[model samples]
Target chain A: MFDTERVKLLAERVRPTAPSRTRLLPVLAPLASLLPDGGLRRGTSVRCGAGPHGGALSLALALAAGPSAAGSWCAVVGMDDVGPLAAAGFGLDLDRLAVVRSGPAHWALATGVLIDGVDLVVVAPPPHPRPAAVRTLAARARDRGAVLVVVGPWSADHELVVERSSWHGLAEGAGRLQARRVTVVARGRGAAVRPVRRELWLPTATGKVAAA
Target chain B: MTALPRLLLVECPALTVPAVEPGAGGDEGGRRLRLFARVVDALAEVCPWIDPVRPGVCTLPIKGPTRYFGSEGAVLARVAEVVTTVMAAGPALAGEGTAVGAGDGAPPVPPVPPVPPVRLGVADGLFAATLAARAGTVVAVGETERFLAPWPVDVLGDPDLADVLVRLGLTTLGRFAALPAPDVLARFGAAGARCHRVARGLDGELPGWRVPGTSRHLLAALGRDLALTEHQPGFWGGASAADERAAEVLTDLQRRLGPEAVVVPVLEGGRGPADRCRLVPWRPAGTSAEDDRGLHGRAQARGGRASEPPWPGRLPPPAPARVAAGGTGERAGAAEVADGDGAPVAVTARGLLTGRPARLSVGGGPWMPVTGWSAPWPVEERWWSRGRRRAARLQVLAGGSEGRAYLLVVERGRWRVEAAYD
Candidate 1:
């Protein structure tokens, strides 16, 4: 008969787990060395709500391409036609990539399913009218165990606000004319890690991330 | 004897009305949320030619239906009948105050009157339909081309295509479709090809029809229909009753799907690298069976982002309902939500559910790993817009077969679950 211990082991086998110790994956860093936790968590959601063309999506694409390059299936959900060009520019493998064109629910459903099958999944969280959906999606990720990346420009005028306790400007490259390096610092997640800063580069080929 | 095709673009902002209500409480509530859905069904009832529904995106693939109806006029008549029937049953079907009367004053309470009159505009092709809907002018067949000829090219929403059309000095769809296909493709790319299709009345020619509107996947109800209540705290305070109801719904799903069932959330925002997904073990409130034990091993699925809550440091307050239940209905039957209008109150949790977990294939062999590992992948794009480009990023994947499976990102190495492949 199946008991709690056996059932627990079976469940653990199906649901993927996070690496015990944080390790930086090898990759060219534009902000700094890779995060100490390896990368984004598998089935939760994280957002880069900067602005239009504010590097939110670019960040998401960068994050998704890393695992996808390693032969794991990766999916770009909800983004219509906008994905292929971006993926190609980064020199990430598209063969392992699938773009699903669907409405919000379909997008959510697809993202939820792909979370298990692919190495990474990214979704675009549209600004308001349905913030509840975003919350539900967050819980879904928790239950299903998929890395959920939610990025979009934040707008308070629309009644949607991210209540932050403090704000430290993320340092981007310091050059005579343009920014060459970028770093993001958090002031309040319990423990504080120094802001990471690194010069950014887009490699010309896949399986290669040498300093530019 | 070649003839130009009539095209129509219908823009019903009212179609977005359904989004106003949160979850499907009942079938009546669902109907109230999307009255057009009833009209679609009524059309099918009256004509039997209307296609089955696909959620999201409005344009119905009506070419077959139009052909089957014998002409565009016949199709229009059928649509009108559907509209009329829905309006006629508005008060009786959707409930009080939902149906508008001729003069207003809220249309006289319960047993409400029929639906109010509606305005329509028809023209040839997508643009024409859009224009007609905007103008409240419905065109008769054969006159579509003439009606559409004088409109501006900006209506299509593609400036590049518009500029090219202007350079070519081509103004009308009828004229544009007359041009060679190769030239259009060469000069304008995909947009040009699309324009040609619209001009030829072949725009919505794709054979299948997608149902328009969102459907909820999770539904919840307590034993013996307890009084459903809402506890809206002062601004982001304790979890609303809705949140509680939803949690129960999630627990039920996890139990049924096994601990391998992953919960992926859509996290809010961040600056430096943050976790987008994570996994929550399938340990519900009271039960942990050995069958559940075996299930927990499969937790290696995507979770959600690891970004600090936008609330920052201040944790989200507790929710009202502790757990919810999944209604014993299939996806199709579940599509009819009944919550607000005397129907059962149920919350729909929408996400992808899979019957089998992900298996990594190596050299024709399928392998399932019990270890969760993640690496960071960086992305930066759009240097041209706003003079700001994306900083590099790191993506992480996690989860182990013995307990959990997940994908996470470590931009600079801070981690969070991105999704659970349950």
Candidate 2:
């Protein structure tokens, strides 16, 4: 027996006061199940490590692909030889992507500057990095609300390790390489303490990420 | 907008000093400036208000000259005669190179240096007038837009803007002018908006078109100041807040690290992964005008159809995640490829492997069993020069099913690891 006009008016009035969307940068649909939050939480750090068979760089590039295509600026630091065409194939918008090459001495300084203005920063830590520098960078990233993706070892909120990888479309001197299949084991702290495993095509036939 | 001033421009193509050599106190640069000053002084006799646009170019208000000389054509002829005479007299003063004093005990006649071409034109504004001078045509007052229609957008002297415009299919001024003003402002920022106005003939000037401190250089060469006040153009204030913030941080980083340390990727047409993209130093707009002008032609060539052709024999996708830093083959790591019998493998003349690759060692590392590999793809480049390269590529999967993938190349009986799929 309620008046329909009154109900509609009341709904509109309450809608404006509803909580805003969570401050999470989106990841590709296929990668959603691998993370506890289903998206990258800003102001946190993620570590990507390689296993006996290396696929760490590919995984990092794929993770950056999502936010980059969504109009966020991404920078790659300390990886002097990172291939740009491959980054482009992984769905990153090259126009917004920058590459900063720094020697071991200035690696942290360069990465620190990028994290200030850039939305997402992917850095490869130098060998035997100073503990103080690592702590300072993590704290800065948190304060600036920027996501830091470390390619090498670092204690972070989440850790994604490439457990195993295999290539498809190649044989004994026959066909060419077309795609890569990998197993990523993701683990994190706090609410994301449970470990999760994902089987994915890091780069499928069209150079894009998809579930296997 | 108010009507732009109609002006006449004269250009000496050969007399202009290269912008790269600023404050060029060198002998050649000084000589050219002095010659140009002479040309300006000669033109002053015909029209009192002559403006030196650059080292070799000058302009004047054409209205008064036209009325005094009875027509625009008459004024152009007079200016042309005066400029030609001065340019022809320039080389005789340098007596060092051409036929030095004929040691014949007779009066020596210094050879005349070839006369540099002097072009004249008239248009409604300085931008159009400069282009008109280059074409050696006099554009009617109301026809500035029509005259600018067919010229390419690169003439705006902004390579980055021109590259984007060409990619968007607005190659000519008329097409660019057809776009609504507000949209250009929103998409391309203030610099683009200014160029858009110039394209539409709504504005008469563009930033960085005139050389700074030209009058000072003239005074130093002639020992007299023309009292020309330097015109300071307004700074661009149209960038978004995010852009400005990013630019500020990047500039700070550039100051800390060298300029070459920070780079951005530019895609180009080529067969190899390393060749397909190059990293150029990031430059914020409005800071380097001369460099931008120099890069204009290269940017256009890259963004045009010249780079659009599909390169045959290009490796199929899922390009390697890591490439050698240098495009040249020297930077690649030396690798050893052997057969099951431990004999070194080689590529034959027909682009075939002498034996099936079984074990591989990269950078003298431990050997790993090869799991899968592709057939050799022959690559022959620059055959006409001494740098001719005859090489073959093979995609090799090493270790095991859960292992690494690499792009291996062989040349002159030597193998190297050029890239990796990670």
Candidate 3:
């Protein structure tokens, strides 16, 4: 006969885990030092708006390097308007990148596929983001161990406004280096609203981010 | 292998299921969801022999399907037949056209045996198939490399492979596939090998196929004078000897193979009730597709959306349904009823019969009678109007398997199973 008592005693009681702590992923601020964490944490989401010379794309490039540097893959989903030339200007290595132009209608499906295996997924939020849908995806990202970055202007009516753990506002361009600087607003648990200014720089000699 | 006519892979999406609408016509999230489900279902219906159903911007592998179907022409016919039947029900599905694996720079291969109406293009391989599908004409074998040449650098768009190819000054599919396998691998590793294989007319991996039993479709043609009862037995039982004037058509189906198929019942206002829009796959022991045709034919003749595809999976959890729930509340159960204290019972006997029923028993508290219920809560946008919103009316909080709170609401009496703690 099987030892039921011993088996029951040996079986560990499962416990529910609390929601993981949120971490701030840093983008290069034109006027400030690199972010404290060096990069965004896995499973975190952020929103950004572009300045005169495409500040949003610039910030994405800085984050892309973090994963590509580790030889991992990164994908951009649901971006239709961003031209290839503009993407290249931000010094993003196209070789390590996969851009999905799903247009506006199929953004959700594309987002679902991209977040499955990629280290980082950058998406432009739906025209009208459903808080419920976003939350579902956020939870999925957490489960899959992937980072999600929402790029575009903030919507007042969006159900979930993935609050900024650290936010950087790009400033107007001033020079060839002008494409880099931005003012960041930071706030969240264990975070403060530091009105810090930072400068952006491209370390690659030819001013182009080489293919990763 | 050289003597065998080059094989072409053609994929036709179900017309009845468009990409944009999950639940179209009258359903929420319409058409889009239905299309995806139908594609999966169609693949399931033709499985084991079809092998693996690959979802990509590329054509499926032809090895397993070709082998099982006995001939290349037979496989093409089977694919076309499924697509044609689906088209009869709704929107016309578009075929992906033909793709061939001709060695580089060869003449276009002609379609043999059963011919297709859609213009087809044969290419040296799958990559060229995708490119040829766009042009409406098939690219022949042997000419794949030469034909793929000069199509622009952006065509080889996979970043890892494309960038390497561009750097090597090899922009076209022909040039990329022409490179020595060893040199390409030495320079680009596994990705280069893949690019080379794709450039050639060969799949990097040989996938399996799972084609299910054939779906049998039944058709019924009847005289205008025929009564609904004459076909009731066939409709419900899926087969019957009805009036001599009526004819039935039957088509075979593989899975969920049974008679008593799910049928969409008409609710008030000549629309299909949510629960009634279901069809069982397999018929009963004695019934066949012939019986199904008789049953479905009568339903269509009576002015309704004819039954076509099989039933879908079970619905998500239900939402609360209150046609008229209203009032300012102050009492303990006042909010539940919503109509102040002692309002007339909104839970009418007829309402109880027409709506989904739920039983609630209060314990450990003073049991107060539900004196009255009122307020047309969350009246989902009036059904007559187009572009109505699907909003649930109730605010429910349930726990998941992990004991996490999940916020769910019923909009318009339809329950949408929402995410946990969401």
- Please list the C-alpha lDDT of all candidates, in the order they appear: 0.38, 0.78, 0.37
For candidate 2 chain B, the 10 contiguous residues with the lowest summed lDDT are B226-235
Best by TM-score: 2
Candidate with more favorable, higher lDDT: 1 or 2: 2
- Candidate 2 lDDT by residue in tens digits, A74-190: 889988888888888888877677888787777998888787767789999987788999999999988767789999978889999888788999999899999989889999976
Could you estimate the TM-score for every candidate?
0.29, 0.59, 0.30
lDDT, residue A15, candidate 2? 70
Per-residue lDDT over B64-85 for candidate 2, one digit per residue giving the tens place of the 0 to 100 score: 7788799999999899899888
For each candidate, report its DockQ versus the true two-chain complex.
0.02, 0.28, 0.01
The candidate maximizing lDDT is 2
For candidate 1, give the lDDT: 0.38
Please provide, for model 1 over B1-422, each residue's C-alpha lDDT reduced to its tens digit, 9 standing for 90 to 100.
Answer: 12323433323233323232324455443444445455544554433322222221133324545666787667667666656666567544544455433343332334433323443445654455556756767667766656655666656566777777877788766667678888888877776686666555555221122222222211111111111222122233322332333333333223222323433221223322122111223332223243233133223211222323453221111110001011111110111111223242121122111111222221233333322221222333334778443222211111221222222221221222222211
> Chain A TM-scores, one per candidate?
0.59, 0.88, 0.61
**lDDT at residue B203 of model 2 (Cα atoms):** 77
Q: Can you write out model 1's per-residue Cα lDDT over A1-212, one digit (the tens) per residue?
A: 77999999999997635343111222224422434444544444555433211334445566566655543345555654233334533434544444444445445555554543344566664445266566666666555444565555321111111221111111111111111122222121224544333333322223122234
Pitting candidate 1 against candidate 3, the one with the higher DockQ is 1
